[model samples]
Target: MKPLLVVFVFLFLWDPVLAEMHKKCYKNGICRLECYESEMLVAYCMFQLECCVKGNPAP
Candidate 1:
């Protein structure tokens, strides 16, 4: 019973916003105001931001 209680407490303390600044973008890229010339937009982020990844240089 004590082990089960500890597991439950650990689960309850887990936070979704621990990395709120770049929640959507992980090792792939980052969240920014806009994707620039050398970056590509992969997804949308909170507060009108964008998840961008490095891309090939523009010709």
Candidate 2:
């Protein structure tokens, strides 16, 4: 029971950190493109953008 409680607590705390990281990276990519920066420098950003867009579709 103690281990299960620890696991649940870890998950609850982990999600927000992951989400914040994702948002930061996403915004960084958008800023790079908006400033007309080179794609080669932020190529990973392109992939991230595509993945998020595809993962979440309009209702």
Candidate 3:
């Protein structure tokens, strides 16, 4: 019973993490905004990309 509970918890957290991994990290609007917003959008985009990559490492 305990093992099953642990597995269920693991699975619950796992799906969202995997889903986040496949999400696209950038949009064109952010690119344009970054040009004028002191690069804030660029940093945000890069952070999101890193999150995606960390969740799903490249080959």
lDDT of 1 by residue, 27-58 (tens): 47788777888888877776667788889545
**Which sections of candidate 3 miss by over 4 Å?**
27-59
Summed backbone clashes in each candidate are 0, 0, 0
| Over 4 Å off, model 2 | 25-59
State the C-alpha lDDT per candidate: 0.71, 0.42, 0.43
Candidate 2 yields a Cα-based lDDT of: 0.42
- TM-scores of all candidate predictions against the true structure: 0.50, 0.39, 0.45
For model 3, residues 1-59, the per-residue Cα lDDT tens digits are 99999999999987765655444555323322123322323224332433111222233
Best prediction by lDDT: 1
Q: Which stretches of candidate 1 lie over 4 Å from their true place?
A: 1-27, 57-59
lDDT of 2 by residue, 1-59 (tens): 99999999999987765554355344244322222212322323432332122122234
